[model samples]
Target: MSPQLGNERRAADGVHSGESGRFTSPVRSSRLSPLAAPAFRYFFVGQVVNRVGSSMAGVALAFAVLDIDDSASALGWVIAASSVPMVVFMLLGGAIADRLPRAVVLRGCNLVQGVVQTATAVLVITGYAEIWHLVVLQAVAGTVFAVSYPAFLGMVPILLPVEERKAAFLLIGQATSAVGILGPAVSGVLVATAGPGWALAVDAATYLVAAGLLLLVRLPPGDRSNAKPSVIGDFLAGWAFARHLGWVIPAASASLVFNALVSGAINVLGPVIADDTIGSEGWGLARSGQAVGVFVAAFFLAKVTLRAPMRAIMIAFVVWCVPMLVLGTHVNVWVLSASFVVAGAALSLLDLAWNLLVQEKVPEEMLSRIMAIDGFFSFVATPIGQLAVGPLAIAFGAGRVQLGCFALAALVAAFALTRRRITDVRLTGGPPPQLTG
Candidate 1:
């Protein structure tokens, strides 16, 4: 069986243990002190900057694409181009994260993205950009994301004490949600007042800044002394472990279906519905409302100890149905915005819980690989979802397609309960201790 993250903490604490070898004490609860770590602090700042810039880029890109073609189909093709590579290269990226210095990998990816964005800005500014140009450049940027994502995730456990990681994730979520609140609007205004190209230049600058900060942040060069040199071998080993030795891979298998339903429905289709029903401004508010909910939940997660990790995750997931309901029913802006808020909080909580669990349980050497496999399957279906949703919406009414998507999400979350490993995870109760693992 796979060793749980709780067991790793149990081993580190030495104060408690059981036949199953997990920390049965509430002392294993997460703490917020990781925010005090210098390296993590810098990394945290970089993420915040990164989120803000990306948010701005989201608005800029939408305006840029629409300005040229004024068609959502053209926009979908641009998005699908980038997303395809992101899903395709994730597994290879995971192996690279394990084999190389994660910081170096992340730094390089960030720099490449910076260059890509600069190229995007130049193309837009020069008015030479075409749909084909964006598709190609976005493909390159998407591939870089495949590497940097696992690298960033794999590097986080190394940056903080084990006990501090849970809280660190919440803080990161808060930072991201909080910044995301303003990203689309502020960038939209800038795109309207100045131009999309200038806004893109701002995004490129943020990537450069984040990359520069990463240089000052030092981390352990991972242990390679005992490992095979082949990257493919490393990936196979990780797959073997998660498949045979642990439950993570199984959970990810479930999530793969989950993401396909949720990612596409909410991200790709929801906005289209919003445009048709609630209007574009209402859609923006709905997004901000979701951000607000996420920000609030992050603070709550930072403080509360989750005694039943998977139970909490599953319960939070029920809220996901609200979005599906809204889309199916053509709810007013008030209902749509409220649904977004609830769904956003649920999504953020899931992100925090899952990441914290992996960082704590998995050994550092294999964390990236496992993370890659997890993420690879988790998101590999996203491009399919994104690409298919548009056509699906065309074939079926967007409402019916979205309703079907939500049903899948609801069913997936419910399915999580049937997996004993996900539900079997137990966090000890009592006043949460400051530090233990």
Candidate 2:
């Protein structure tokens, strides 16, 4: 998952039954009806703008590094620099989000990120860009993201009623998907014609705009009286709660493995492969195809309820193998792009299922910390994978490395299915399962 996907939170509030925390039936409305609320409308528009820039930035950052030094290791170092700090500070970020006003936290982080990205754009555009310059800027940006992510997730429940939360997520997902389609394709053209620096500039502009829009959103004051004595205490309480949950640890671990192996292969090695075959423009199209798949899935999922969410999640994992296989074999650009569409659909399903389950199951107050733990587990090994994949590709060849990643992802998915705690759990209509000691 990208950092944007990584930053999601859900909880039952306002619309749940007393004490039991079970959801009451939401008043029926059109799926897009959540946009009617002023707060959610502001939040949604900001997200759309932010996602467009972010999607473009992802492609731009990779090519920017390549333009400076066309080696996979160089790209890996830059990517690792960002991932490592996010893993390190994620728990603390979660703790802080729980203690402070989430909107303020997000706004502050966005301002910092805007400055950092702007600096990066200046360096690159001015022809003073170097691997280390990109590395340092990205590292700062990553730290800001670590703080902003939990805040971003925790803001959802505050913005919408419990009944509308699902629709809000689906709407946001759909908007993100729509922009995901547009951003990468446009990014490709910009990178091809103007240069990566211009793309980064666009991303910087969006951050500032998003920050301004956030100012217009008015959220209800969060209850912070129950906060622990210290951030450490808060984090430890969250850890205690999480450790007893049979599925959380295992699910997070699997995410870690998938991201380490599969994500690294796609982000790092896939670009290298694309450069040799389809070129950067074609690479952007492939990403856009993936976005198209996500858009389609979000549109359908909004209309139907998932019966076996975990089963669907595991199936999504298995589907990821196809894209890896396609990339490993250096398929034609059309075939490669087609494979990504399937993979993207699977990703959308898995994310929706996972987010809804957590939103319904976890306590509202503990949401940020729990999400932080999930983020930490899901991302801890990403740096290792990013740093190692380049050397592995150099040693084993990119195709073989991609195949290995596919096998590992498949194995992880299969193992996750064997755990009864994961497979037996359902989206219940009553109080969340009590966390046992």
Clashing pairs in 1: 5-361
* Pairs in clash, predicted candidate 2: none
Give the count of colliding residue pairs in each prediction: 1, 0
Question: TM-score for model 1?
Answer: 0.86
Prediction 2 TM-score vs. true: 0.92
* Global lDDT of model 2: 0.80
Find the candidate with the highest TM-score and give its number: 2
lDDT agreement with native, every candidate: 0.73, 0.80
lDDT of 2 at 246: 66
lDDT of 2 at 378: 89
Instruction: Give per-residue CA lDDT, model 2, range 1-437, as digits (tens).
Output: 00111112222223324333234545565687677667778878988889978999988989999999998899999998899899999999998887776778888898899999999999989999999998899899889888888878876665555667778888888788888987887998899999999999999999999999988776545655556799998889788777866678888887888888765898888888888888889999888888888888887888768766777888787786577798888658789889888988888888888778777777666778888888999899999888898889989999999999988888888888898877887876444333333
